[model samples]
Target: MRRSSVATSFLLVSALGLTACSGGGSDGDDGARKAAEGLATALAAAAAPADGASTPSDPLAAVTWTGTDPATVAKEYAAVIDGMDGIAPSVEVAEVDGEADKPTATLTWTWPVVAGGDPWTYDTTVALADGDGWAVAWAPSIVEPSLADGETLDATTLLAERGEITGAGGEKLVTERPVVRIGIDRTKVTAAAAPASARALAELVDIEGAPFVKAVKAAGDKAFVEAITYRANDVPAAVRTGIDGIAGARQVTGEQALAPTRDFAAPILGRVGPVTAEMVEKDPDAYRPGDVAGVSGLQARYDEQLRGTTGRSVHAVPADGGEERELFLAEPAAGKPLALTLDRRLQTLAERVLGGVTPASALVAIRPSDGSILAAANGSGTGGQNYATFGQFAPGSTFKSVTSLALLRAGLTPQTQVQCTPTVTVNGKRFKNYSDYPSSAIGTIPLEEAIAQSCNTALIGARAKVKDGDLADAAASLGLGIDHDLGFPAYFGEVPPPASETEGAADLIGQGKVLASPMAMATVIASVQAGTTVVPHLVDGVDVSVPSEAEPLSAAEARQLKAMLRRVVTNGSGRGLADLPGGPVIAKTGTAEYADGGTIRTHAWMIAAQGDLAVAVFVQTGESGSRTAGPLLEEFLRAAR
Candidate 1:
């Protein structure tokens, strides 16, 4: 049995050794011996020092870290390693007891022996296997505490403060405060009761006719909750009672109610439209869909200061649908109001005086001292048409002022002789005076008399002696070709340089496209009277820091021009104005013919200045200047005086 056992054991060993060499499993004793030999070889290789390098004196060394908390350092290290390409080693953190302000902790990690992948592990001490023993590298000092539940990580940003606006008299024009507007729905109530609501509303409100009707119709059959018809800035106590008394009518106020006045100064004060998509895309903060903007006149020019900042408020309501209550409220910002240089009284007078005239008349009045527009009115079948600053008409004999100025600048005095005849021929074209009748043999008439009588033949002959360019220049100097910048849309009447001799002759007579506005004519007269050219302005004291100055003209020339104009009123075609009660008034009249082929439709015109007031009037399709515009101007001048 012993022999068999020995043989069998030898066979087993042989088989294990074959298996081990051929990549097969081995017996226990043989495997143990081979593993022991491999371990010895590895130990010897690790213990040996590198070539030309000395061995460490303290092989099994320990290290202590003394800096920030161990957990923080570990987290930072992990974050840094995660950002790197290779795998990170494992690390362990241990807490150390301390006060909240000063934390304490420890961390331990092992440098792994494997060559591939992550080569580190966690242990009691931060150690690395070096030859036959372990070596501690670093030990952390403290542990970081976890962050609390609710803490802010960033801050909120605030907006800039808005600017303020005030009137010329230092009155607050706009403010950023809350306001209420009360309106009534007439459709919901009986027509018999409409007068009651109107009376009540009129007590504290100004009703808008067209908009009110539209709003009521828009509200439809809704009763006890009807939409507001008119908007008021602030709801007065009396008005609120009236509004509440009418069922379905309510109050609608706020920034939305500040729609600009559209029809009040139409053409002069332009209309506003809804915010465009382009506006919002360019500046998301500045404009929104329903925002009110100024389109023309003083409103457009001072839009920046007039429009105040807008604010928002948040209200807290019961989630369970209990009584609605206020939590916190933010006051709304309001816009500033504007006070214009326009004299309302004079404006009314002008309108009333012109009302009875033909449906195509216009009038303008200006203060020569400061250029403040005192009154501007127009006549059209419809009340909204603006002709004073917009309508363009032939100047007729009024343009003789420019011709006279040109003649004076060219050394021709008022006494200079010019032939007056029934007809004169120039460039194959015939020019005639107002009538074909004969006159006295006084072949030569003074310039003043020629202008007073509006003698087209004499004036046209005299114009031949003046330089062509100089006449054009004089017309420009008198504000004929220049555009009017009144903060609103305006037309610069055409005063083209004469292209042909016939055209030149026609131009001398204020025909052939010598068009002007009544306002421009008034400005020309004002300049001649005041000895200075003044730019018309509708707002006073707009800039406290920078005041406007007048453009000067020759005083002697102004006197001569004034004398001629006075002669027109005292003894000429404009003589009808001489009988007025006020002091002597200087005036001129014009009657221009229609261009269309028919019986000439006359454009009656008059310009007069008395004391500090200066006025200009034009009536279209009238028989004559003295018959139409003269009477209207007389009434206005009387009121002004």
Candidate 2:
């Protein structure tokens, strides 16, 4: 019967009698069908839009009136609905029986018990005859999954513990550590002063004040406005003292699994916090409101493995002081540990060394034997840029190592005679060596001597020796300009085909269309020392495959290139590193030029190898590779020993 027909039948039935009766009447079948149809309509209305709107404000409003004592049922239904977090309820009417005026309606309730569908359905009958026309006889028992008499709907959440992140030696990289949460305690200060207080805190903490001010101004009058979270040891002693002196500012201390030092490999470790609304919408099955999970870095990349599966249980509580029945039980599992390939000592040291650089700078170290990343450090002056593995900058003269491979592939040896000049022009672009180019190495010299002295004009003078794609091929062979999946954000060097001879000349000195991360340059130096490809890796067992068609460098050719780089430290531009206390060393220097807001600046770069260790250092806006980057490399090598 139509919904209107059900209304008509209900009016006729109520006029006769809607209360429970002793026997069936002549129109019992029609009344039963109409009552069942009415039940279906009421339940379906709960899920339908209202008055041309997309969604109804109160989804269960229609069903509330269909039960006995509408006032009491409405409150109870709202309570149950409010408690359900990830439930989508649906209902259907199946059959009915008894007198036409006091018919019993059979109903089936279906809803997903778990996310992504593990539907649980139950069938029950409701008496539709009371004082009103076809009034519904409702109770908690007729709800989805058949709630027990006098029992209320509820939920119990079992949270899985967050995981830990470890380093190469299986030492703790991130673990439960003390932290400080700085915020404004509303009870101690008026909301009107929130903006001023935020500015004060910003000045004291060295963070942006505008966003904090806005957040504070928008918070409730009695809300505690949290500003930022920092590892306990990270908050400078002076800053913490200043905070303690503030009238309304306070610190909330807690412990969480995090890096021992807040800035130690921060870009790689990431963080965990309360789940965002946008994240929940994207993965509804994996999250809920108020849940916390990894948001970025390795924490987010391995969140699933780190945050183990959650266990759940359902209990049927009794109204009378009796025992509760266990309806469902699933034990929880703790999270697992994420292992990395970092060297804790080395990473810590690298951070300290770069901490003072005035311009953006980075240091990357790797062990070529197994392609493991030991350290990736970004200086405080970098403004939080992850240049160690992600920043793309011209590599400068350091790229000559790759060019040497190209030269080697073209039949030139270290002793081959090549002209080293003051300047040369290619494709209408004039190229010159550094202004202080040593006169002794500027004339006709051995090919190795040209590389050692880092002569731009000399390398540019030999551009005819390299064809289109040959430099790119040679770079790939040394693991410089290649394709890779390191399982993290990284920029392997890129060597696009030079569009002109000038571009080729630029390419010869690590300029033009070339770009590389500190990590990429480290791999180049490491691969040269190892005589093959060196693909950098961070996470253990997470194979970082580099897809390259370029042939690997031969042991013989690698030794030849190695010998040339050695000469750099012993007799040329890199001579400053000759007296390093560490074991014998091989090094190359580079200076890359780029335009910064209409002003010209150069990036200083150096790549070196000593024993099993290989390192790359970069300083954006530096004078020269040897002068700017040499000391940093020396410091690292000395400390590593």
**By TM-score, who's the top model here?**
2
Count clashing residue pairs per candidate: 15, 0
TM-score of each: 0.59, 0.80
lDDT for residue 267 in candidate 1, whole number 0-100: 48
Tens digit of per-residue lDDT, candidate 2, span 428-460? 788888878889887899999999999888777
How far is 635's C-alpha from truth in model 2 (Å)? 1.0
What is the lDDT, from 0 to 100, of the residue 18 in candidate 1? 20
Q: Write the per-residue lDDT of candidate 1 for residues 1-641, one digit (tens) a residue.
A: 00112322232233222211111122333332232222222212222223343322221111112333334433433332221112122223332222223222234332222222132333232222121121112222111111111211111111113333332244333333344545555445765565455444544455545544443444323222222323344455666676666543557654332222223334454433334456655654465433455545444566555555443322222334455433223343555555555565676677778767656777889887776677777665435666787778887877787778877878878887878777888877998877522365226888888878878888788765777577666665555556645554445466787788777887887787688888778877776777666566665544311112222357777888888888988767788888888777888777788855766676778888887777889887776677778888988988787
Candidate 2: worst 10 consecutive residues by lDDT?
Answer: 1-10
On the 0 to 100 scale, the lDDT of residue 505 in model 2 is 84
Q: Whose lDDT is greatest here? A: 2
Residue 221 in model 1: lDDT:
37
Candidate 2: regions farther than 4 A off: 1-72, 90-133, 140-157, 178-255, 310-332, 545-548
